[model samples]
Target: MSEAVLRLSGLEKSYNRGKPNEVRVLRGVELALVPGEIVALVAPSGAGKSTLLHMAGLLDVPDAGTVEIGGREMGGLGDRARTAVRRREVGFVYQFHHLLPEFTALENITLPQLADGATERAAQARARELLSRVGLEARADHRPAALSGGEQQRVAFCRALANGPRILLADEPTGNLDPATADRLFDVLMELVADEGLSALIATHNLELAARMSRVLRLDGGALHPQA
Candidate 1:
């Protein structure tokens, strides 16, 4: 097996711990994603898919477990340190495109670099290269409003890759698109994972998409389960 780029061991998360209305969102969940592997996290609604993704992506903390990326455990890290780790090692994609309305596609894609203190010029160059890689070179200067849903999503995919994150946590990346568009966008996503050698854990309800990944894991009953 490959060395893991991301690992979750004995992971647990809960809301309102030890009080009335306490609910465990994830329990004893264990998963690992190695470099260049794309795995699917599938489950029905209310099965804690998003909650688990949040913890895995470092957006939320686990109540009683550990999340490790690049060999660093996040269980005891402070908020600032965790944010830095996420910025350097993880990229996240949401269902919504979430592109900045005020910026062009290239600018929106490069925004993360500025947050990390990179020069605008350097970021722009990387962003444009990504745009080209996604076949969006001509759309670089267009605003999100001028793009189709699929185009906007393609830009978002490029944006997620902007920082060269070791792992990506994508939540329903193609959920909002039409079936045809969804398949196209999913292809772009998988191609990038293969071509760039990045690992990914993508949460989805699409079984066909899940089947296309290196492995398919179903999140059920607040735990990670491998599908046969």
Candidate 2:
């Protein structure tokens, strides 16, 4: 069934408060991502794409509006509840691969599972499976410092999928890589998303990447609208 896994309505956020320097970043944003969807969000710089992404990932709360994940509204959830929801439902990827330097590739992928109290064996198995999918099984024991930029990003992808997150939010995940590398990374990302039946909302500046998604939505004047 087509159901909204991640949804936002009437979202708004502003920096500074009741002062001459105050500026509204997002003005009444609304969007949704269904299960198995790969949607692209495009916007010019300073159009509040990052801010909206932060709010959707549950890293920050909007000054107004509500964000719901897996049918649970986060508007009234307390900090403890929000953290739990974030850990259980949302996965995030940034432009820079944020793999822990000290952790082996396997360990990095399994860290979130460990945090959620999964047994070592179970987490290892999951990590191994993901590494195989990302074609990084041989790098399992290597540290981030020992891997190339593309390899590091592959590990990051594995880590993000460790918990079987319902929604994966990728903010310019390939923005740091060269064209060929970025293309390969996106291929791996889309493969995993399909294989796991995971939903995704990726914010990007690359029109070619955006065009390949199921739908492309442009954020303009504080709102999201489908782009041709």
Candidate 3:
């Protein structure tokens, strides 16, 4: 079997540590995602789904255990090194479309590539290509405010993939859309992931959507279990 593209081993995280009101968000969670696999993460609200995604994407540190991306241990990496690895290997989407209102769809998608050292022309070309793939080429010049919710989220998807990251960690990517829109957008998301050959861990409450992925895991009581 191919090596896992993203692995979380024995992860543990807590809030307000050592305090009377401390809350444990994760406990000994282990996960591994091989290339080109799309895994659905199902969890109740406030079940630490976001926290798990953060750890997987290197946005947060675990109190215990390690995150390995592309076989590199991330626990001991400095902030700069972690950031570099995250920029080059991880992509993230949230429950809401967080596109910058001031930037056009194309510009928003181009910004991350620029930050990663790509030239402006190259970033723009890549942005256009992704937009085209999602059928948003004509809306590239529009800002988030000018686009519908579904369109805005689609642009957000393109922006997330702009850097060609190996792993995509999404927290309720279509939670805000209506049923029909959510279903359609999810189809686009799966297509994009397949085209990019990425491994994805997407959190959602929609069972129908979860059933479409390659595997399903339930996040309950701060740990992961295979969905029966």
Error of 3 at 154 (Å): 0.4
In model 3, the Cα lDDT at residue 90 comes to 91
lDDT of 3: 0.96
Give one digit per residue, the lDDT tens place, for model 3 in 1-228. 999999999999999999999999999999999999999999999999999999999999999999999998999999999999999999998879999999999999999999999999999999999999999999999999999999999999999999999999999999999999999999999999999999999999999999999999999999999999
| Model 2 spans > 4 angstroms off | none
Which candidate comes out best when scored by lDDT?
A: 3
Global lDDT scores for all candidate models: 0.90, 0.91, 0.96
Predictions: Cα RMSD each: 1.1, 0.9, 0.7
Candidate 3: how many backbone clashes? 0
Alpha carbon lDDT at 50, candidate 2: 89
Ranking by lDDT: 3, 2, 1
- In model 1, residue pairs whose N, Cα or C atoms come closer than 3 Å (at least 3 residues apart or on different chains), thus clashing, are none
Off by over 4 Å in 1: none
